[model samples]
Target: MAQASAPSGLRFHSQIDYAGTMKISSHAVARMLGAWQAGPGPAHQRLSDRLRLLVLDGRLPLGAALPSERDLATALGTSRTTVGAAYRTLVEHGYLATRARARATVRLPHATPSERPAGTESATINLSFAAPPAPVEILHAAYAAALEQLPRYFERHGYDRYGTAELREAVADWYRRRGLPTAPDHIMITSGAQHALGLLARTLLSPRDKVLIDHPTYPHAIRTFAEARARLLPVAVGTCGWDTAQLQAAGRAAQLAYLIPDFHNPTGMCMSASVRRRLRLACPTIIDETMTDLALDGARPEPCAVHMPTAVSVGSVSKSIWGGLRTGWIRATPSLLERVEQARPATDLGTPVVEQLATAVLLNGRQTERPDALQHLRSHRDALTEALAEYLPDVHAPRPAGGVTLWGMFPEPVSSRLAAIAPDYGVTIAAGPRFGVGGAFERHIRLPYTLPSSQLTEAIRRLAQARLALTQGATGTHTPAPVA
Candidate 1:
């Protein structure tokens, strides 16, 4: 990792090269540390816990230089001694690295068996990842069929940056069936939708370039764009949903925009066709269609590009089929795809060959969408909402028309605190703040319906107990692990 110079007047001396490393500003860190003093503890302890959470949850990137202790103390309205003690505590825990006169940089502690949360060995219901379970027969058959066809490509080197021809056309046909005309030439296979987003960010965004995003969007997308060094322009998606005027205004100044109009993650609110057609943007938009096939209330949505032809669509069967398959593709102009192919080698040579063949089989056979699976998902979604109502009555969970998760709003801002204690109760959740920037969504959490109804109900039951413990001022000593 590259080192960074101390800001003017900080007084740091180092022989190490200090160029190209990212340094988060004091004010920015202050904003992300919203209400760090709200939790019970000594001021230094509270600040340290909150800062550790920020690092653990990935708000602070590892190797990024922190503000000088004095500057941070000033920004945080605390004593410099308090700041110094917190930094020292972090260093002792291996969450930060510091040298004489140099600013502390974020790092993760080395893992030990004792570090595992209690009850982790037990069966824990995980609501952190929103993905469907595999259709056993369908998956097995697809792979079996793929093996029968695999020998045809044996004569050549298996290092095609562009994925196999079979899968590309199958993906193209997927869009064509949904009213968007696509050719295989316009498609480029990726490991997954997240990979596609990273590739696009690398190829297109320059440092400090503005990228527009939905507030309370996908967590990994937030991380990807931030890692690319892009300045995010967030447009809120509130109860009434997206504001086209606000999006267009932001888009006019942004270099790129990313939207998840089709069953938007966490919220699971699908953008109306009217909004889709009227929502024109000044910048190139990447539309995530990962949840398009999980519609429980209506027919599947048409591709967003049907209305906005210039939009780039990224889709994966992770939600529709199984996450383990790890197959996804980008739908864009051939010229744009050519650029993606050129940039692809820097990240990964290609997605796995057998997986591509299996995915191609699944797509061609239309096995990704099964009525039984959709029905099961609908049952799980209903069960999760019912459980929330029965146990956590004050938490309002909206029934999504599509998608695998719901955004649950708590009566208070206890999201991060709740997540820290949730694992001990045998349920792990993706805290709401993980999906947003600047410490927003503190009163919300993303609840996935991926588990079976019985397990979902049990998870909620445990969550209710956790909340009760939290209300009684029982703060568990645990840091949340990363979420998908």
Candidate 2:
């Protein structure tokens, strides 16, 4: 029998084994490279540019094998030559590495001195993350109060998988304040909301478990479920908000569901009372309430669990208070809490005593509901939308009623391209694909208004310039965005 050769005309030095490497199918790559030909450029350049953006934005994981040129060409409905040229460009730029007979693998370029952001100017503004700054006075007072109570925990061993009793009750009261009855046994503390989600994912999901999630939902949640090897079933959340029929239809076959109905991430649209009452799912659901206290409109929406009692609730003060406070909790039935506590040792011992004490003080005092903080958020939100109108009139950025972000829709699919180049204009943005699986939402970008009004205005001004450059097909110089 003759040995199989590399895909058509391609050759390799040696036969490479791709046993454990993540290989993306040709069809999937084509789907991810959505509308690549629509941008201004040669076919090959356009393809390479989109591929590079996918890699840079982390849609394409590093070291993942790409489909063969011939295979991808067939899937993309392009010639093999075009695909080959694009691959070559990617290889030359260090976005990919090709072995003799092996498929090309994804890799980012090694940054040189010139590629690094220089001074504070490059750190001028960042809209990539949707988190608020610390409330200095409030945070200090809470910690001071916590320090006073720290002596109470000195007698016992510092291991508490179930968290402190006082904090758990405080977390329970947080729900009770919102019209949902909860108990201390219903709460278990974790480092933060993200940590709580990870614990739940580990405890609830097995390999290949079906998880229903909102399309273009929280990016980290997408990553968490994907990392767990769970099959994701996405229901589209449109400008009009979630479709109840579509959500229920998708949930029927799912084992677990994750939702951000309380001022949903990126889009910041809250699930209305009517929808919450009507919405029911076959699977157990996890509802994230990180932004519940940041309601800018009239009143805070009642908890989703108010309608669906079996739904688990995860919340943190990271959004409402400060990102520095790494404290959060899980609100579920006592039986579920028992399972989580049993699995807690594998991850870590427990949440920090001091932070938990401080969070208890903050929650009991209702500091997260500060009038001044909410007012500032409202003002900054207004400023961000105003900036978008004045600077990038063509882009549609709807003002969210609560969360710190503005979901911007471009006239074209320029989000990833804009994100790649935005830092050169002294701004950083979260491209839309980051929030979604595959390469969906190419026409959208999520901009956070957590910065000061002046910074928000300036960032949008710079962002508009970046958008102009991208639209004009200018492959200008690049500068890496400031790392948080």
Candidate 3:
């Protein structure tokens, strides 16, 4: 077969023979000459600089086999030792890779923004959402019972804008079980936790009202507050947890403080009871207990709404059972519930009648323990943590007592870069800035341990590879480069 010609605009022969049975191309020689002439330095430094430039400039495409050290030396008018040193430097910097059978091949140090790995289809391993699977036996029975009671709701207009009495009672009972003093009249059901937050934001916040949140908090909560025109005050949350003193100070300065007291999103840090008490008194609190039921280790030490009667507690079955349920409730004073209800119609008519019935059924029944589901989640979390510890020991990560994610901190300020590289590893990880109030947490990454154990292992492996690429000194993906 005739050798392949180089792409247009270059002047070079198709092929030239080197050693016996080995062929070198003029295009490759031209790349070497261009690199050598472009620099002014010592022999080895100039050669290394040239090779790095060629790799970065796409003159040598990623995964393309490079000419042998001896051949490159002959073509570039340099010693073989100098060529070998150049290749070694590029390899060390992640610009090239070599193996026994294959020659040194050009490789971009960072993943391209558009490149994505296979096996991450919609139906495949989805680690993006951190919620767990529903308890099958309990959920199915609830649906069956709700279907039977469907006739009862058919008679009414079926739209209780505030919430149905029966469902509110169930929500109150759930809080009561946790030792909090809750009243049924204080409860208002909503489509989900996000809806509840939206209602609160619309009802309470004016333009640029200061709202306090942890540094690495829920992304949705930040967006909701921003849309409500609130100026966000973000206090950093360390590996140990939030700095309560700083939080209280920020709370005092702000109109509202949004918090996740149990199994915090992304970080999974349950608030200490002392911090909860202090925060409640310092600010009008909106507590999101979305991951309350996902405590794989044990119960949370403090009730999210325990200290402040003025605080609004947002509860949802989305994390406990299934997101498809779309049923969540707010526990607050009746007066507050009335205000939220006034703002509710602007967003939704009400929570769906059938889904409310289903959630009520589930809450009312003697729910069975979900050992299998718990075990599956626990296994995934452990695997991911172990992989991080083994492969990227320099990164800091806390194994949460509960929740579905492992929040990791990188050695460098490269979380955004890693997020861009993750898809190449067949994973989609949320960068730390996504959770922060004002684009903080730039050195962090959140990995959801919600997929199967096998998938989690593969995802972590890919993350390790991506991290290496980002930190090993290759020109980053975000940098300007020539397009092919």
Candidate 1's displacement at residue 123, Å, is 1.8
- Residues 170-221, model 3: lDDT tens digits: 8888888778978889899998888888999999899768887766778778
Output the lDDT of residue 46, model 1.
84
RMSD of model 1 against the true structure: 5.6
| Candidate 1 vs candidate 2, lDDT winner | 1
Q: Order the candidates by TM-score, highest first — what do you get? A: 2, 1, 3
lDDT of 1: 0.84
Q: Can you write out model 2's per-residue Cα lDDT over 8-89, one digit (the tens) per residue?
A: 2110111224577888778768867867888456999989988888788766778888999999999999999999999999
Mind giving the per-residue lDDT tens digits that candidate 1 earns over 215-308? Answer: 8789889888877878777888776677788778788878899999888998998888778888779999999999888888998887878888
Q: How many angstroms is residue 442 displaced in model 2 relative to the true structure, after the best TM-score fit? A: 1.1
- Best TM-score goes to which candidate? 2
State how far residue 403 of model 2 sits from its true place (Å).
1.4
Query: For each candidate, what is the lDDT?
Result: 0.84, 0.83, 0.70
Answer with 1 or 3, whichever has the higher TM-score: 1
TM-score of each: 0.89, 0.91, 0.72
Best by lDDT: 1
Clash pairs, candidate 3, are: none
